[model samples]
Target chain A: MRLTRRDALAVLAGLGITGGALGLSTLDPTAADGDGSSGDRDPAETDLLATMTAAAEVVYPSQVTGVGEFVETYVTGRSRDASRQAAMETVVSELDEIARDWHGAPFADLAADDRDDLLRELGVADSEPVPEGNVSERVRFYVVNELLYAFYASPTGGRLVGIENPIGHAGGTDSYQRAAMDGGQSDVNAGENDG
Target chain B: MADERARAPVADADVCIVGAGPAGGIVAHRLAESGQNVVVLEAGPRFDGDRREQLEAHVRPGLDGPWEMGGPRDAFSSSGESFYPLNAARVKGVGGTTLHWQGMVMRLHERDFELDSRHGVGADWPLDYDDLKPYYAEAERELGVAGAMDNPYAPPRDDPFPMTAFPPSHSDSIFAEACERLGLDMHSVPSARNAEPYDGRSPCVGYGTCKPVCPSGAKYTAESHVEKAEAAGARVIDRARVRRLEHDESGERVVAAAYTTPDGETHRQAADQFVVACGGVETVRLLLLSESDRHPNGLANSSGVLGRYFMDHLFAGMGGRLDRPTRQNHVGFNTSECHQFYDDTEPVNGVKLEFLNYAGPSPVIDALHADTWGDELLEQLDESYGTHISMGALVEQLPRADNYVGLDRETTDDLGDPVPEVHWSIDDQTKTALSRANEVQASVLDELGVDVEWTVGPDNTGPAFHHMGTARMGDDPDSSVVDAECRTHDVRNLWIAGSSVFPTGGAMNPTLTIAALAVRLASSLRARLS
Candidate 1:
């Protein structure tokens, strides 16, 4: 049931969570997933998402509502696409290989700071042997960016940017200036404002 | 009086406006306000706040959504490239294509009207920039255009813009400095949006989702004018696909138009005057479909040029990491443009430099292009998302006789109407413009101390949705479809509006131009009918 923002609105509306709030979705990122319940993730699938979710957590670090659950579901949706799944598998395997070579353990098992350090090291490494095209960039854009947006993608992130109900989000809250109704004010407003 | 005698009229009015886009809406509003009966037929459904939210929801999840800005899919487009050759994210219905437009409201350069005299390539417009200046002002007033008065590149006007330009984003400052260092002129992009609430619309909150949908109606759409038209006593019928125009004997003037409803019922609407603003493609399709015993080659094809000279802008650009963190794409996006090359009439021609708008393809999407996805891909999105700045050249496309739209008699629309077969190609001028664009890209990036990581287009450069010239307006009846007033040469009372009458595709979005011309046409029709 990977609910869209529209569906999430319906569910939230049912609960009377009706104020135009962005953090409402931030409170429960996993609410977008099928059934709005976190108990249904397959153990194997959860394990696969563990590394990506942890990496996303490092980017924003739960500043508001926990983004980990929402990210897992978002990645789950990506993994469902065959092309995305292939790309993720290639990049995730490469990341796990790098972690094992660096610390004798899988990437998902690394300490939170250690995971952050791994990303930072890879961010600036001069001679790291991981190929830099598909696996290299996908690691950032696909896995990390999507994971990072899991928090930023929610209504909560839009509020931080001063837009309580950013367009493209589920909320339809409007914030307009009253004078826009006077369609005939052609020159007065034009002369008053400076670019 | 003519409408009262009609037997089974679904609707009837003094003027019947086909296509409830910016052009149709403005004409309806003007005629209705002048005490003339007007009926507007829109092929798309009406758009409102709830619909905006739903469309906005489609844009929420990155670029991997069903449609950009939640616009409906074009069932008849040719998807042979990364983007459709003719139209991508082009909309139909009540708000019309403006529902998904990015709200760029720039006027054509004054020189654009005389491209034939200036460049010796395209046909000259019947009216000059000064002739359309008043209508442009009226259109800006109607659509709420925010602009800067100091920009030398903008078209000169008597009054100031309706609103001041949007405040500079962090990216705008960087882009300005880089452009200055590179010796290129740049300024705030004149936009059809409120900088601070006006006309009951909220100022732009910089949500960066203008394409495909304006989530908060902060941006103007045809729906705004549609509402005004309705308020002025104009009746708008949505989801009414116009089939063909019926003309009187001698093929001199149009009498009525037949349109089909969503439920497959046909109805005839007669009016004293008729307007066809069915975008660039459908307008030609309708004319071709209206061919009768007297006019065998299409209703307005006496010169055999009704479907000829189709054109759209060519987009080419380069992007790389900025010297410092701009954090630009987060808000007030696409607010800068450089028109230094826009007035060039010689070798370089008009090449508009628009500041970076949307983020490029994701690493995975990019990797798919490269045929591999590796480990370092994750970090690149961060490096590029906020860290990179880009500029693109929107090169002017000179109208050519070969690029045309015609009826593909083999295919039919959902309503059994003939589909439009778009025949467009990148001409030599576009090729020259591409070469110049590449040089422009190189020089700008070098001055900014950024290396060109990826360059898109020089050959087969992407299609810009500013479709124009299928039924171009010119002084010469020998080589044009319509007169200077956008009225068809073969038909007396039938007029063409929108970009379809553009003699040349200027390096600017055609929405404002279309609205302005529609306003001018409305005045012309009012005078004629009064």
Candidate 2:
């Protein structure tokens, strides 16, 4: 599936990723694969996109749409970097091991509710998303945080939240002089207000 | 051993300027326009590639900075109380630092030239503000400055700016209201960026990445002048680093400049006159490396002050969050500034206040670090993203004998020559200035009912990288390297340009002053050559 910028935004809306992850600390770009090594399986052989898509369905808001094709494109692009692909592969394998131990199934094959429970049980939320830390922290950095960064950095995700254009995208002089159209009040807030 | 390498003849010219930055570009253009043979040697390659790609490099994470030129070749050592990140602040190319400079082009105040005579601190400039007034106007015209005439604290200018000033960013209006309450005036900052297209360049489209890259070509860089100089028949050779200046047997004049090419071959460019415009640090390094039997100290160092009195501007800042939306990050460059305390040089140094437009937390980064995920994450972003406001001040740093650019014998660059060692420290006077600036900033923020978040004073202050006063100009040869005319007193045919000749730097950006001096030096050379 061809993932246009629109598709990327759809994926991000579901992911609900945004800023403040990278600011925690600079992730070691060259972090080696974990010592467990996923039962000595090479990370290159792992199905990174499939595993991430299944995980996205669990973490994403129930209202979000268009998760599949965008995840495919994002994973494909991310896998081009040897280091990032290695980290993704290691974390995916570790995640699958946890799923098998807990539910007796692969992570992608588990039910959405079961997958969500496994993530919570692993204490991924409580730990800092360190690149070289334990399995849970690596999952937070590589999987959860990466998805959020890609979405908010996109034009659609930014516009959905009243940031018509993110940094680095040219918004022209008028954008600087004028106020943000929504005053940074996202559609999510509007929905809650209407309710 | 590197000197013994066979020297190839590069070019013969009436004048050879050993840098392609702002000063060198201006001098080369003015001289070449008069039909004189001119050559400019640059240490780095021209950034002639697609700028959009360069911008992408800057925005993308885990990549090197905007320029691909600053690598191992530009290494240096910092041995001061504060470790100076030398290479991060400067660029070496046809356009030089202006390629990445924020494009602020403020002029020195009248009192800046009389610091010693009036304030009894720092030596007075040999030439007053009036002497450089005409050249300042010419430089403003040449650079296509956009400014408002509302700056009451600035030195008087006879001519209007080429373009009208850009309107302040939306966030600046927020600070203006608070400043009004405190009885402080907010005026437009004079910038080299075009408000409307004047010199065949586009108006600022607000790419918001003006520091490292301006993909739209809105901000003015010296490459335009370098190109103009070339059109008028000046030869600019990029990727050629001048190793040393070779003087005559009498050591009274510079005879030739020996430089090394990328292929490690040494070449000599002979000229009737030489202008060393390679910035404050590199200029001193080149002069120190050119030591000989006759000039045991260094070339143009008869006064023993070539590398003395190094100076840079320090910053004081405060950041806070407001309840209302500030609409931050909408603009990249600042538009409003306060120069109210610029002339008050008693008890504390001068300070220039600024209201920053890019102060808030980046929405993407903020959301990513949210403790909550899903709906709660979205709520956190809505609550936190657009409410940040910040203010900053440029504090004047007085020159000290110990704060200097000396040669580091232990560290060397790609050329096997000793790198420039920056001996820098924040003095009591500078700390006092920072505290005063912070007090003023805090007052404005407090008036706006902002929740104070972080403050930057003497302990956290960093250099603005306005390198000045190393090769200070003065009337007395016993205390200075260059004379009032910017010609080296020890060497009649040698000249120095750029901020290296600034005797006392005011709390202002130094590019306009550097450009004015360059234009003046070119006029002086025209008379001598004729």
Candidate 3:
């Protein structure tokens, strides 16, 4: 199933969750369909996310599986103000246009290698200013990077990166390497001094 | 009647100390104990044990785990492109910034006192190491520091620490093993947090929020000294921000201090002698703000060097995944520390590195290391949690006249005063030292059998609230703001305390050194008053 950004927002709001970032619930165990699809979604959001996924995959291929979903989750979770919602919509539209212009075919239909080439070009092009009315290269780069960082750093993303969740306390450990060696030497010295 | 009603009468005292942090508090306590009428003026609100808990709750929302600021996050510097927020919790309470400090207390290395003599960089302190040794001992006793006095790199000491070092936690043990494998000496970290009760304060419960106010009185703060001073009949007025120094016609001595209460009511407090113990930034700010014809550049800035030579310890973190899961994941915090590389000198220069050990990756900061997506990332994170050892390096920054704090005309704080504009750029030599420290840290971690995952980029440099040397001390009044006694050269009765008087900040934390200096200043003030 597919979902539109608006539809996602409505669904999230109905569930009484509000924020600018996706939490654990969006990837709930029960919410997962047997086929690994976002079950029973409208066609519009799916098409939009598919395009975004294609563009993001080219930029960060390692994150294709979850990056698009996290971005959508973030956009939907943020304030329901028209300006913000419109900005998200514009981002989706620009991704679709960039994908189509880079490749002769629709983004979802492009091969992974082709997508990667286009993304590299976009990244390089993004280092400088683009023509007015076109999405600034830095903004595109930032959105892609932010999405990748936020997702990978998130709980689910951390699992993917192989970083464990909070395993212990912060700033509570003495873990200085010098202190440990000194401890051993001190013990030996204590024995020697005892004689 | 009209003139009398317009101005509040100045109340005289034996001594009036600005700020109530470590230095100010100690000075007040010592002076009051010496039967002097001491009045301490603190700009921050009064924070007792009960009020501390409330302050914690107010700040808890800001400490949303690691990688999050516990209060209103300040905007990133306009000059720097990095979005990573620089959050230094400045407590406007009686304890000052010590209220939210990690209670790591170590005296400045003996070599640190004579930087100019050794390295020919900054001016050597007028006083020598031996002169400050007794005061260092007194400060340690007052703070109830716990550690082994057997540090090879440490300077000569007359006595030992009050208590034994705190036991190493699980992570600390693993890190210690790694240090041992690398042929580096490690020991229990010396901390201001009580290992066992000494004074009236309780021992540290190992609560993770040491950067914030400690709810339990385990951590020593300036408020403790304030309490002692008050009990000895020293009045401490909170929320009183001193505006300027009111002087007589001679301009050689400070007659009184004009301060504004929280209600914006102005009053003048007269004293026989005045001491400016306000922290580095505020001390310089106040001096510069107190402009008069006698000293145009600022009080005690005759050499035209009042606000110069700012320094802060530069910190860098390097981490990698361990070969196997150790007991590091089992503990709340680490207790072991590494100081082998502290005085490690190259062919040309020496560099210092202090080990910063944590039990686990903070929830938010851990994300920086995670993969963009997938099950493999999760697996890696899980394995790394127990098997990872990260090393943070705190290197000494050379004092440069360029790095300074001044009032920003454009920016202002909530109080309508000009916000402090910090202009600090490290030199190539300091940058080289930082890089070398990273190299040593990585080598140490690798020797521990940890898989090299990633290191943070080089441009990620920020001060950790340990700002110092804005008002440095030197023999010459023209080159330095204060003299060896921390007294402003221009104003005979005016004195500056805390790290502001430091000519150079060593690699170690500055709290202990500040406390020692405060005690020394107290002695000087006591002799004068008596």
Candidate 4:
């Protein structure tokens, strides 16, 4: 989970994000997750981070590694907004209340399968993800959808779906100019050796 | 102390340029390079921070948004048939809106100069494209343009672009096939971005955030000229907003540029000659704000045409998902465009089609907004995100006196000056053009076998942020603010640059034309001084 600069570049290359890393380590902030620790963050913020990370495990693809550190970094960064902080807290508390009533545990403390079942039973996945709407909508909006967006938006998760260089990342000209091969699944080895 | 500061000249110069944008940057560099004492007053600050860090922050989700570009300092209102997002379209900083521009730079077609003479609709430019041809070449060199000479529909060029054209993106190749099928000539889009290492700046490393932010600084911003101007001995003052132009007793010449600093201290910049290059909206707003008894309408409004003839290119788009991967958001800027419909006469005046490199919702955004979650959401993104393809077109909007930028009586900015009230509307001609452009785009998309998802037609068209024709140039002083030389008809020493003086905005991007006119104006200013 803790990658050196060279290792991060190697990982980025392996992910098909960039070919022959031209100092594009900044492309994926999570790729440079040193120590993988939330150092000196506020206690309440840490709690929120934990809740979000727990939720991310259930929502994210099973293949996606480092869900904890990734969600922690993303959630901590987004918590700068007071309203977003409050919204996360509200949603987490609502989920925790449901967990306590049904499964006699906090949502973060519940098993991943049980948490997934609860989310499904609550219709959180089916509900419209309105930011200011009801509990299910808020859960869908702030937790499920937000975490999903963060994962795929990252170069690592984007590479899973043929997005070699997501939107804001600089993967160089050859990466974009090279046509996709074998349907839309991006030939990972096609232009890796080219300039 | 404030009164004392107000009376003292901030800087005395042979020439004073306001707005420090593409126009002012070019003029300042040219004049200062000629050994003239030039001073530029910019309303915005220089973004001297680490651009890579800034771009990283910008790309991050759940942040306030990209680039700390606009705020209360750039407040403006709009009221008409259609709403104009004025602040979103502009940046009031050192490079101006070019700092965040999409870097597409194309020369105006020869017929664009004779809109009235040829089409008998909009007013004709006093000077033709031939007049600007030399300056256009010079501007291309200065901005480090890259283009292919394959655009058969483009106006005749005496010289090739300064750099080689960038190869088409993977998506562009996909679109090109469809375009070829539809008999649309898709050629390389001329851009102000670097295709190779020409200037000191690096070639495009494809940071992909060309608009609002270019992390690698490959895309040309007027800040380059501003820096060159400074090195050539021009005094550049940032965060100094020019409130108004003050004329001498005769009112025939502008004597001083009265501006306020960020510290709320007012100072006057004395100059022998002045140039206002504050884009379109703010240019009119500044002139309107300087209303005096001698020229009660405004300093340059003796002809009563100062704030009239507002123009912006209306955009039409159609987007859909092809079964195969179109590879969306790969290059961030368009690499190919179609100018075949530019001179069309029937449904629209002019049109330029672009095959967008960054099409469809970003993977993150699509995942975030998808109704499904977990496995279903990932499946949806895999199917939808990369497969999305979109085509966009710029439709010509003829200048109308009623669509103008005037002083907003209600809203005031951080400087307490009345903000610009934009009265904008889409005319029937423009609406018809949008509809026609959409039809053409639909045919191409349909040819590609794309499942058409969304289409932006007349009802949902918006401006491409190419503000033009507020202070139109003409031969007659009776009907125009500036003459053929871009000098104010009323004030002999006052000059106007940028697209604001354009009589007709062709369906091309205006930055290249703006740079061309800036070069010409610099030559004119140098001649007057000599």
Candidate 5:
């Protein structure tokens, strides 16, 4: 009844097995998709990671390269529920189909501007929240918030704003204003906040 | 006896104090020093000095760990529609709940005593401010409270604080500027934390982790007084849970107390004097548990006011983000107070503006899920991190007889004791006060040039662990539970201390007032012992 972003995707990906209802032919998985490459992780699960990374690159471009890979690895490593992991695979595969239809390429291979344009169309830029919606809004949720969390979870992402280590990482800003107090400067106007 | 959990076989004492907490510490110290043998029972063991550091956290005490929180399922919200956090905020070790107090010490307003005269609601205290003023001074000295000697906003006092106030942080500057712009009076909240080395304790390092647990012991915990009480010839028996009070045949006098060991051994201690210093909820629970045919409703229930008129300040929360990046000054506990709204208000309502130290993760979490990401996320963090500030108005709530804590027959603790069920819902008066508090906070936020984020008031008002009333102190036996001396009306030798005895909770933090009352009760106990 209630499906997570991942679950909806897995079910939609399976729908491509029947062929051409929503023109989701490319979203169908190959025989090798669930080959269980790394320590029993299904190949479909691996592809889901790749799709998540591609979505993250849309949010934070791989400016010097490897940022996308970082996003993929970080997002994949966070374990949700194996019970719904199959659905998550479907979601990721359907994303590839959408990207192929939009730009005639895999979601990960699309140009940065094209990705942003697609994200905008998904209404990620709008005031609406992602998780609050349904299967109809799955792709946008995956590309925007889900991918963004994966990207931000990485150390490279943390470095972008000068938080050397965020919570769930290691070490942190012990005193945000102690130095200012020690220096006898009462008024402070400049400082970055790490949420 | 830090973490030692001493099990003394002895059962005789000149005085028996249930709950080795703030009230217990002060009473034990005072009475034991006067050469009366004292036995203090503690339900929870103290954290070893070495472990205390590890136990300290930046989070609120309730969220820290399971070990720090003692006692039954903290379910005071069992009935209240309001969001009062009864169980999470309170601690039950040797230091009691003061183990995690933020140390924002302030005296009750002078007119706080005559609530009946001022607002025609809530009963007036049997004694006036003058009666307790001297004891307040003594408590301040004992705690080595730090504040401005000539603070304009405070009530008149004979002497200045023992220590000067800490230097203002960036947060203080923001608050001061806003107060000045709005023509409001602001003052440094009196801190129990030492500004300089006093009583062999270190000063506050501004670690910003005062709540939950203070590692350095810079912020005073009742553990300090527990230690003092021990050194001055009192014994604190840790993990000795006092479940019942045994009285004489007529149920007019408390003869002894029965407590259970952690391993299920029951022990009884006989004493001439008994004081229930186990905070508001537990003290009332103990009295109710001691019910017998002679006192069928509950011990000291002849007045039928054993647990009623519960009160806590209605805190209205208003938050905002400044247009420009500013260093948020919440490194220490909330230090600034806008008391301009405190005095001259009707007894039914008064407001005190206090800022809460908040380094919110909301912006970062929002960015993580928003239209922006990567470099833009970083930019947003830089612009918004320290810019977040909260202005909370602690509005006074008048005590009502129905908002109470009583025994729930259906529920039981681990020891098969009835759990205290709280029935609290904010009244119409509280709703009006919350609206006023919200408006004042919004106006103050407007002064600081920030868009108001949200308002917290009666609509979503939280139930509290800051428990008061239940066994309130007043002049009459028919209308109240205790007298001016904090002695239960039905029991002559039995007394109760802490905020539970407060007839009216003034628009300020209650620790100082609790300690002041304990000192006053200590004086009374000394006279009785003599």
Candidate 6:
């Protein structure tokens, strides 16, 4: 049966889940299952993923989840990547300028596969002389990581990747109940009532 | 008039106190009540609840940013890059950092104080849980804690709490039930936030912004004690940054202290005795700055251990997805905790874990998480905002000499004072402890039938705002900065208060313990005066 947001939330609540996971389940995109991993993607998605993985491995060599698809998905959704749009635009502009210098064409006009290769080259070039007004490589890495980490580690990403959101059942007394039960006599509670 | 005149800057008082946070506030209140004329010198401005602009400046960027001591126009560049820790915005005001603290009060279990005796590592404090019990009780009464006293995990105390535990928010109830089902001992977290109309303060409105400053006065701050001290006739000076302590040629006694005011004028205030209640970092920095020919390595550097053994709690997140939705969109930020991992007698020497209750990431904070977003992401955010469970462990860090704080020669604040250069690192024991805690967290989530996601690692293990131990206390002057009474070994008249005196970084929050220690010191000073 089709589930509405409210209905899904109720089911989640009934099942004893709470917080961001419930919100995410309700907003689950119809195209999520298209790629069998909860979102729609072009058939060329595999190539993009491979490229992203290679770059992420170099950037966050110690990090285990170095997949490019995961990083792209995270940047597109959870991160404040859009807020860094101005910075992204500068990078894109520099890429276009580089393309014009090399092939006398705009970056967008290049074949999709070629575009990936060019982007990879830009990422790997340690000390390449790019246009003066372009974004720095450090800024690119910062933006990419910020987007990737937020999307992958957030409550939403936890749900998609089968990472359990611990808020629901990890053992503890709610502060109010502890306070109610203990009467707030804890050490920090000392000298609290002189007012 | 006679008392005021006699109390005014005598050659010396019995005890000179420093700082006015939990330790300083408590010490001052207890000593003043015992009839000691305690002089508290705070570098920050006096907190006026009406000062909206000053309060707002804390969150904004620049030198006078809310986290900064001077106003936004001041020069406060963050050294957060090399430190890998956010610069703590410490208030130089009367209340100290308590003015902008979330009052999650818990005790360092009996095992914590006896870490050396039990674990065969670290220096054991001269005093133990038993010695501090009465003081702890007195502090709780003064702080007006609202919690149950029957916690099995907590050490034994003499008296009960003033009031019953505050009611758990709707979200807390769900988390508590889940914990019990998993066989973990969950208890009410002791907070400085009010649960009832105690001592005239109102209950918390669940405003969520308890860090910068509690507008409602529901959270406990040293300002409340300052008011009490004022009512009892203790004089307080604000906007006065004590530059150094002046001594006579003999160098046997402290003559007076020199201070700088906000108006760029220098003034010398003569006092028979002095206390250093500035924070851990400042207290050490001040001593180092007060270098004299008689005592070269700063005020009390004879031992050469004035600023060593610094430590702070290392935090890690344990997150997972539950089978059902849990209430995440709740008002209260944290109301419950898992205290089962508190005691170290069970054989773990390095770290301990606690479960924090509450969910739903704020928009800005959500952006920090790279994994959870998009239409598919929104589905998870919505589903788990209230229903998800996230538990984190505030691990106990080992006392390493390398993790100490010193004055940074290159970076100076607006007043030309050197900013604190923190040198911090973790040892193998700490890493092992964190890994063990993470494993337990995973097991607990599995029991709840939720999908486990992120656990603590090198990238995720970051420093919390709760910084401590730059100036530690011990029985021997050769090994520590301060003594059991929070007095500096080098300067008899100089006392150090606040979490800086902590010999070992405990798993629980440090404010309550700091307050209790302060109160105990104040009482000691009063007795000596009498």
Question: Whose DockQ is greatest here?
Answer: 4
Fnat score for model 5: 0.14
Q: Which stretches of candidate 6 lie over 4 Å from their true place?
A: A1-195, B1-18, B50-86, B169-173, B176-178, B345-347, B350-352, B363-384
Q: Write model 1 residue lDDT over A63-115, tens digit each, in one string.
A: 43444554554555445446766666677778888999998887888997787
Task: Give the per-residue Cα lDDT of candidate 4 at B351.
Answer: 94
Residue B457, candidate 3: alpha-carbon lDDT? 24
Model 6 C-alpha lDDT per residue in residues A84-169, reported as the tens digit of each score? 33444445455567767766766556664455455556552232222232343432333333333333323333333322221211
Q: Report how far off residue B452 is in candidate 5 (Å).
A: 1.3
- Lowest-sum lDDT 10-residue window in model 3 chain B: B72-81
Q: Please state the CAPRI-style docking class of candidate 2.
A: incorrect
Against the hidden reference, what TM-scores do the models get? 0.74, 0.82, 0.68, 0.84, 0.72, 0.67
TM-score of chain A of 1: 0.60
True contacts kept of each: 0.04, 0.38, 0.12, 0.56, 0.14, 0.04
Ranking by DockQ: 4, 2, 5, 1, 3, 6
lDDT of each: 0.67, 0.79, 0.61, 0.80, 0.67, 0.57
Rank list by TM-score:
4, 2, 1, 5, 3, 6
The CAPRI class of candidate 5 is incorrect
Global Cα lDDT for candidate 1: 0.67
| Stretches > 4 Å off in candidate 4 | A1-56, A66-110, A113-150, A181-195, B1-9, B53-61, B68-70, B368-373
CAPRI docking class of candidate 4: acceptable
Residue B277 CA displacement from its true place in model 2, Å: 1.4
Query: Each model's number of backbone clashes?
Result: 34, 12, 46, 1, 15, 134
lDDT of 2 at B407: 93
Steric clash count of candidate 6 = 134
Per-residue lDDT of candidate 5, residues A1-195 (tens digit): 111222222212111111132222222222234222244456677677666766665566435256433443334333233533555566667666767887898766787677667666645566343333543255545446555543332233433443322221211123333323221211111111110
Q: Lowest summed lDDT over 10 consecutive residues: which window, candidate 1 chain B?
A: B364-373
Model 6: reference contacts kept, as a fraction? 0.04
For model 4, report the TM-score of its A chain.
0.70
lDDT of 3 by residue, B345-464 (tens): 541134445544453454323333332223343444454455566766676777877777666657655555555556677667766777887787787877776766766424665555
